[model samples]
Target chain A: MERPHNFSAGPCILPLEVFEKASQSVIDLDNSGLSILEISHRSTAFVGIIEKARELALQHLNLQDKGYKALFLQGGASMQFLMTAYNLLEKKAGYLDTGTWASNAIKEANNFGKTEVLASSKSSNYNYIPKDFLVPEGLDYLHYTSNNTIYGTQMKTFPKKENTPLVCDMSSDIFSRQLDYSQFDLIYAGAQKNMGPAGATLIVVKEDILGKVSRAIPSMMDYQLMIKKESMFNTPPVFSIYVSMLNLEWLSRNGGVPSIEKKNKAKADLIYSEIDRNPLFKGFTALEDRSMMNATFSLKDEQLGPKFDKLWKASHINGLNGHRSVGGYRASMYNALTLDSVKVLVDVMKNFEKTA
Target chain B: MERPHNFSAGPCILPLEVFEKASQSVIDLDNSGLSILEISHRSTAFVGIIEKARELALQHLNLQDKGYKALFLQGGASMQFLMTAYNLLEKKAGYLDTGTWASNAIKEANNFGKTEVLASSKSSNYNYIPKDFLVPEGLDYLHYTSNNTIYGTQMKTFPKKENTPLVCDMSSDIFSRQLDYSQFDLIYAGAQKNMGPAGATLIVVKEDILGKVSRAIPSMMDYQLMIKKESMFNTPPVFSIYVSMLNLEWLSRNGGVPSIEKKNKAKADLIYSEIDRNPLFKGFTALEDRSMMNATFSLKDEQLGPKFDKLWKASHINGLNGHRSVGGYRASMYNALTLDSVKVLVDVMKNFEKTA
Candidate 1:
């Protein structure tokens, strides 16, 4: 198979070094004679792995004492959505709908209690993040997706009301850029995106916001149990945890989020410039709310569809197709995506524009 | 540092090749330019992986339309102990306490409904599997552990009863030998010992025994939800599932269990013979009920204990320490243990006997 830039939504691309080192651990971890998979989670070595992963996460996010406890949990961000509601919401909840994931959060939260859709841009086919969205006054909590990957809409700026705690699903944008996490009571992202791997979900929850729920949560859903155990309530995905550590280490060494944010700006700029300059191509999402992580667009000449798709595939480019939930093509420029790859896509788009 | 024979009860030894292959997937799954750790559970490739893993499990266990569904879950056997009760036992339950794990099953079962210790060998320190154990007339199910890795005891025979289900935690010795599995209503195992890794738990439950409970179980804890989703209700541990496939493949090529049973017997016979015949060492477990997996023993000369431990460590043998609850050395010869390793232990015992 030709080397293609993977734009598949998670479990997405990981650094080559993370894979190679993680592979070797399957045979023998740090030459300990036991496969990393064979070691006990209760063992000191794994305990260190979990702790280091947590420490790196804190350092990388620079939220060491922002009233948040970082937790690496099983299940995925979907589970965290339920857990967030299970732990926090008693009567009713508030959700800002920008895309599929935020709506998914709303659906799961509704299973537990009343979930009010505070605002939605669904009437615009989710092309924009509704700026005038109202987060209800008496909501148990307000939730939003930081970056909408499917529809390619992102909220460039957040409205801050210090009285209410914010919960954000930064699944697609985590580690891609720094955030004012202090404004959020809870943040969760599945690791497949910019973090490490798919099997673990990273949750940053403010401890003070807990202990208000009246329901008896089963042990698996209880954030308190996860916190008490320090996310070692059971055997965590060790390999995922370790690879995440490697990615975190990579992020920290490369001047952290500030440096990566610049690289992100450059890549997003190149691809968006291509989309704007081209006559045949048009970005589908509302321009002001365009995503930096995922750039989505389509051809104005619908008949050129087959030729354009075939061109990108022939050039060994992958994950360039948009989500089937909405039509057209999308390019996910995650953290692992390099500037050259974006240039390749830009060049491909330019040629397609000229030919059309 | 030293190559010690691992005696860790769960999160125990696994097939070396499984570890190697599993590790490779962690970094790069099927060379898809995607790490298995980062792959989507919904992707065609990962769906195949989960499906095939479940198929192999069903095929190997000869589950045979017994109305049993096989699922890969988390929280280990301990969670299953509670889940089994939550799903099936609306009334009273019965548990036979042979050792630590079986008692744990009883403990978790009590959290849901009434539980009777139908039989217990705790009085004898659980050295022997009690025979002619009474199966209570009216109970939800009779629970037993097939093998006691901690106490070095094996239940050679199970209670023969119809109309009632037999639930067993075959965690330590699930694939060690053949069994009339038709007799068991539900069987669950943590995969670290005879199966694969720690993060995943395998459960086989008959359909008839479920849907009886009144208490609301968290969706994560409900076995039925796992079965319904084919164990992908949430992000299943992809790396662990892949490793389990390798182990299952290894087991299949190994002429399945018929071949493994013979090898397990031979290894146990060689080591048990040395312990029974040797004068300086006495088998700590009852002779009639010694474990084929965990062989426990102590020296007649207690002062030479430090020397024996150091000697084994110097010889590059490891994981020989027994449980802190039961102090002594235990040689756990799971499926991956070569007969040659047991010979090494037998030879060491012989040399110590002559010197004493």
Candidate 2:
């Protein structure tokens, strides 16, 4: 089977080698005479896979001694939006609303504790991340979604901490860039975007900050409970975690985040530069805060949008449609996305310009 | 890759056709040139798959106009344990504690509201399902685990559920028996046991019985919110749902649950008869209440248990070890396990008996 450049946003393209390794195990896993699905989460074969995956995820994030523990959990990242609040929000929490997912996270966090939206760029249709957010001193934590996947804006820097903990929902752009552990006390992302599959969520949490919440959390939802059980609180999504490990292995082989971040910037630069140069299209996000992972752009002529979509789909290009919450084309170039895929988009843009 | 008789308690076996069909789609899904993972959850490819899987599941259970909505959500049946209590436990809920999972359910449910143990079989080592448990009047709902997977006991007939809505965590024994779903208002199962994989959980709930709870429920944990969104409230486990759909199709082709129930009984009878007749071993659960899905037994000469396990594993018989919480062997016969596999186990028992 010939592989095309897959760019569907999360549950997105895993590496081709990952597909080969994962598919082989489906038929016969680890010489256990059981398909990987049938292998027990408690079995020795699966334990090794899970342990390796957890270690690799932590190392990839450079989270060693970062006052945080990594957890592979089910229910994707939307779940962590709630779990994070449930576990952390004993007192008031502050949020910076940048885009759709960030607003959703704030709404979910509101259900648990008082939420203060320190700033919002919604009035500008979220073109730029809010830079002047009022962070009240002594709040429980200052929470923000680091990257707006839908809006294609990112917080290039963390808010100054007045001793309040920082929590980030870094679902779309976690490993595609470099980060300092000193800035944030907690971070979580679904493995689908930059990591691997859809089932597992990678949570890095400061251990001491947990268990301070006063509400009666369901045991499965408790971060401290999950940490004590070593992410085996229930049968973890075994195969997804294994696939994520393979993805991380690929990342490590290609030189870690610094190397990948440079590649990611190059890909985003090529596509965004095309949108800027061509008279037919215009970039959507605030230019100062445009993302390296998701590039949201729109045609200057509205009628050409559908035509462009059809053209891309015909070429077997995928997941370039902007989120339904926003209307345009969003070319999400996560870690697995190649510079060559970006070249195809650039070519399409140049051809579209010649015709328009 | 020779297949073994996989008796994994959960994260269990699936039909070969289901795996083959699913694998083909993994790379090039539904003619979309996208891995099923990369395809949009809202795409016609996935919505149809999710809806079809729900319909097939309801069909297999013979449920009709129960006004029940089927949802495929994450967090497994364990999440349902709490969600059931949150939705229906406005005043109080009743639970029947049977095994490890049952007790876990009760513990989670207690967090929502007041819970009473209507009955328990722990005194009998969970070997006999309670025949005469009392159903207290005026309860919001009656919660029970249909099959105790670890202890290998099943309810032959539920205690008469009248007026009270019957909510069951049917995680272990669903699809293995012919059931009158009218006896219960709600039924849910983690798909790992009899259905397909670990990532997706199936919940069947009556629409009219919801919204009675007084507590503020988180959106992900709220059944009504998920049903309203048709389980598209968040990005769901697309690959897991697709595989479950393929498994459902296979089950329908194999003549639905009625046909499968006959085979399940035959398989259970073969293994149990050997355990009863052979001097080397004895069945753990009572004859009337033993589960068709999980058959637990141990050597009469306790010293030979380790030797028995070694013999089975050496012959490539896998996942036969009992849960650590319950120290004995448990052979799980999910829908994917054929009668031939059961025959092989029966022959092994006979050979071991003669040699002993």
Candidate 3:
């Protein structure tokens, strides 16, 4: 049976091949006569699996041997919002509030110390990425969200500054496109999008930026300790990391980030072009700032939502509904989603347009 | 192919039927044409899965509709060490230091407020559970580990006290035994053992116990907010929770905790009986306090170690090596490990003794 067009904005789509291998491994891992779920996290096989995942994550981002370490942590990026501040925020930190997640990161940071919102797009409902932000000196770190999944906006250019450390919540758009990954001191992404599954959060941090905070960081939240323990700080999400390893292997075999980036661009272009050309719908975010991962759009006539919804449902589409915060349609095009799936969605949009 | 007798401590054995269903769901969930890994946590299907899992968890613990809320949070029990303190540690908290995890919990709680060690078994290398410890008045809560995985000791009786809240880390032997689970104000367990896999942590808390602490709790760590969000505080460990839901369904179908407890007792009895009867083997922990889940034992003659190892390996035993802290063999018979597996291990031990 053909797979449905999965556009759910994370806990989202991963490679189908990864799923097949994971399915087999759940019953019997590498023919070891034991299920992956039953294996100890400290087992040699699991250590190798997690190590390879860490390696592949850095390799995809072109951050190998760059004074950086990758960790597969739990609690999603939401936990990282607290941890980044827990380990870094001593006196104060700077935040670029692009969307809901960034605002949340700032909220968690307030529990530790001062959180300076250097720039925010909340006034405009986070419809576009805030730019031309002035950076101040003596800040512990400058934080930003690389991609705003809820608002359908992504940072095209990162803040370039010296002395201050750069931190990013790349939950929605890491490994989707090639970038100067080493430029950021710390980067964290929830594995649900463009990686594998939901449980694991991929944190790639420059080692030098740690140990500067005065506060005592909990073992689970301490990145330096997690690195020292090799992401096995305490029972690192076994199955999540294993499947993530499989997905990263898939990404590596499919020409890594550069190759997948081209495909992602194509998918984004196809859907966005249709939304622009088709008068019945309008894109949500600014054209220049629209995310390549999640393309949020709205029907021109609110009364025609039922008609468009029916068209998409008939075409075997899934997760087309936008977040309630942003009332419209969101077509999340993660790496695993094929371009043919996007075409099916565009066709549904065209059919809806012609019919309504 | 015959499956190995898996004796992994935690992230240990789960029902094979759960594995089969999880395997199929990974490819396609209930004919939904979508991989379980790809479904959004907010999706209707996933919401149902989480809700059912939560209900089952409470039902198995016999804590349903008794002012208890079950949350499938991420970061394992390690995160809960900090969270329990972050949310509840006020003025002073008492801890019963049974083993490594208990020590770690006390350490994390120290960062928050005054943590009084009520009693400890560290003097004897945690070989026995400390008994008849006096419960202090005005304590915020009394904390203890229900089962010590590394040391192979289980709490047969809990502190009988009123007024002071009771919190227990039931990570290893949660569903393996029937208990007055409502007596404890809060209970947390890592899903790796007796539930599902590593990643999701089950937290069962009474509603009235929250919002008592003065310190500001982070969103991810705050149980009240998590309960309010119905465990969807953030994108949860989706696949882990789904597998846990499946495992819980399996447990429910197999007659829940009472029925599993009898089987667990049988497995523990079989292994312990063999250890006592076989002259070459001696049990590790105190006989009275021996764990039902993990039966740690060592060879009487050191020279026969290789011979015993060879016998178990030949019999297809896996994860029999004990924890580094306790240098012996540990046979962890979780809820999924059949009595036949225990018999196989016992036979291997009998054969080893006869050969020696």
Per-candidate TM-scores read 0.89, 0.97, 0.99
Q: What is the lDDT of residue A38 in candidate 1?
A: 63
The candidates' DockQ values read: 0.43, 0.62, 0.89
- The parts of candidate 3 lying over 4 Å away from their true place are none
Cand. 1 TM to true fold: 0.89
Best prediction by TM-score: 3
Candidate 2 chain A weakest ten by summed lDDT: A1-10
Tell me each candidate's RMSD, in Å, in order: 3.3, 1.5, 1.0
Residue A227, candidate 3: C-alpha displacement in angstroms:
1.0
Q: Give one digit per residue, the lDDT tens place, for model 3 in A207-259.
A: 99999988888888898899999888789899999999999999989998999
Q: Give the best candidate by lDDT.
A: 3
Of 2 and 3, the candidate ahead on TM-score is 3
Name the candidate, 1 or 3, with the larger TM-score value.
3
Please state the error at residue B130 of candidate 3 in Å.
0.9
List, residue by residue over A1-356, the lDDT tens digit for candidate 1: 44467777666777777777878877778878877766767778888888988988877777887777889976677777778888988998888888877887887787689988878887878888988866567778888899998898887777756567788898899888867767778889888788877667898888888888888765666777788989876567776787788888888778889899999889988989889889888999878888889898988888999999988887768777778877888888888888988888888888877776
- Can you give the lDDT of residue A344 in candidate 1? 84
- For residues A7-45, write the lDDT of model 2, one tens digit per residue: 666667766777666676766676665677777888888
